[model samples]
Structure formats: C-alpha cells, structure tokens
Target: MIVQQRAYQHPHQPSEVRLVVYETAAAARRVEGMPDDAGYLVTEEWRGAGKVIKTLGFFPDRTPALDVLSARAQELEGQLYRPVAPAA
Candidate 1:
C-alpha cells in the first residue's frame, strides 16, 4: 500500500523527480529459498534516459521512509548531498 507521494525539483537541472513510499509484505505461501524483503519501499523516478528508477531503501516503518524523502528533497535543492559521490 502506498503511504505518500512527493515531487521534487532539481536546483541545478531543469528536471523533476517523483518519490513514492509504499508498504510491502511477504506472501503467506512459501516461495522456496527467497529472501523475505518485506517492509516500507521507497522508490525514486525521473524522466531521463527513458525513465530512471532508483530504490532508496527498504525502511522498517513510515517515519524513516518519510524522513528519507525529506532529506532527499533537501539534497535535490542543493542544500545537502553536494559533497556526496555521484550515484551509480
């Protein structure tokens, strides 16, 4: 289930990025030897090079998910993440 959706504008480039926070759960039935990757899913999308998708992380709860989104917004605004290396 989706909890929140946020859009951010790039400070340097004329581009917009969309963020989605959603909750996911493991299936009741067994899927063999699969990892139980169940939790809040944070995804980012931008219209560059045919729609790029980046998974921020799998948070345990809503607060941390939103916190990440907030920090990402700040980073996009050139107030943070300037010193960080470029994402792969």
Candidate 2:
C-alpha cells in the first residue's frame, strides 16, 4: 500500500498595504494625475497572488499617510511594505 500526504495552503489573510511615495508632483501626476501642488502623493496598494486587490491614495504628505496606513494594517492584522529608495 502507498500513501500520499496533501500539501496545505494558508487561508488568505487581509490584504497588506504597499506604500509608495512620489516625491515630485510631475511623477505623481504621471502616475495618478494628481495636481502639481499636491507636493507628494502616497499610494497604498495590495497586490497578492498575481492580482491587485485595491489601491488608494493620500496627498501632500507621507508621514501622516503612513501613520494611518500603519494603524489600518494593525487593525486588519496585515503588514505594510515600502520601497527602500524614494521614487523619482
């Protein structure tokens, strides 16, 4: 007799936020059409299993946006990921 064991996959958890900051108004506008005076645009996105779940944005500042993102991630038991270098 031969027996095989099946692999187990973890259940899908709440989506995580990948925060990206666009330092320049031009770059932010190119990506999300934000106004030039926006100063900065912080994008929050969730991409998992080869699909994008959701994408949101906050304008003019990164620090406060990140604070809110962190709180939301904590509430949802998810994680926040960001790029090491600033966007051009």
Candidate 3:
C-alpha cells in the first residue's frame, strides 16, 4: 500500500494598489488605462530601505483605496509596500 500527499495552492491576494517599477511614465500610463475603473493611479519614485530602487503605482479612491493604504501601512510598518516611490 502507498500513501499520497496533497499539494496546496495559496489564494491570490487582491491589491488595490499595483506595485510596479517603470522607467517612463508612458509605460505606466499603459497599465493605468488597462483598467476602466474610476480610481486613478498615483505614481511616485520610492528610494527607501530595499535592495534596489523601485517605482510604485497605486489607485486612490474617495474611500477604500487610500483608506486601505493607510491601514496597511500602519500594520506593515517597515514592511510597508507603497505603490510609488518618494520624490528625490
């Protein structure tokens, strides 16, 4: 007789803010327009603690978007993942 083990698949976590790094705004614009939703993507250059510099892209709505960012920031703290980078 033989026993078999089952594999597990993790659920995809939905993010209101899309974290990405783009050299040009045009490329980022392309992704921003992909979603025909109401919210807009806020772009920024982030240069904080990390291996390499990264750009962030996120959506901020009148309610959920920014609210979630704030709460998550508080919860994650040093591990916070902003969609954009800070200005130089």
Q: Give the best candidate by lDDT.
A: 1
> Which candidate has the highest TM-score of all?
1
TM-score computed on alpha carbons, candidate 2: 0.43
By lDDT, the candidates rank as 1, 2, 3
TM-score, every prediction: 0.66, 0.43, 0.32
Per-residue lDDT of model 2, residues 8-80, tens digit only:
1224443333544444544435544446565444444554465453334445665765565455445444322
- 1-88 in candidate 1: lDDT tens per residue? 8787776654565445777788878663354543366767787877545678888977777799889977776776574222222223
Off by over 4 Å in 1: 11-14, 28-37, 79-88
Question: What lDDT would candidate 1 get against the real structure?
Answer: 0.68
Model 3 TM-score, all chains together? 0.32
Which has the better lDDT: candidate 1, or candidate 3? Answer: 1
Per-model CA lDDT versus the true structure? 0.68, 0.42, 0.32
Candidate 1 vs candidate 2, lDDT winner: 1
Candidate 3 lDDT over residue span 10-48, tens digit each: 133222332222122323344433444444342322223
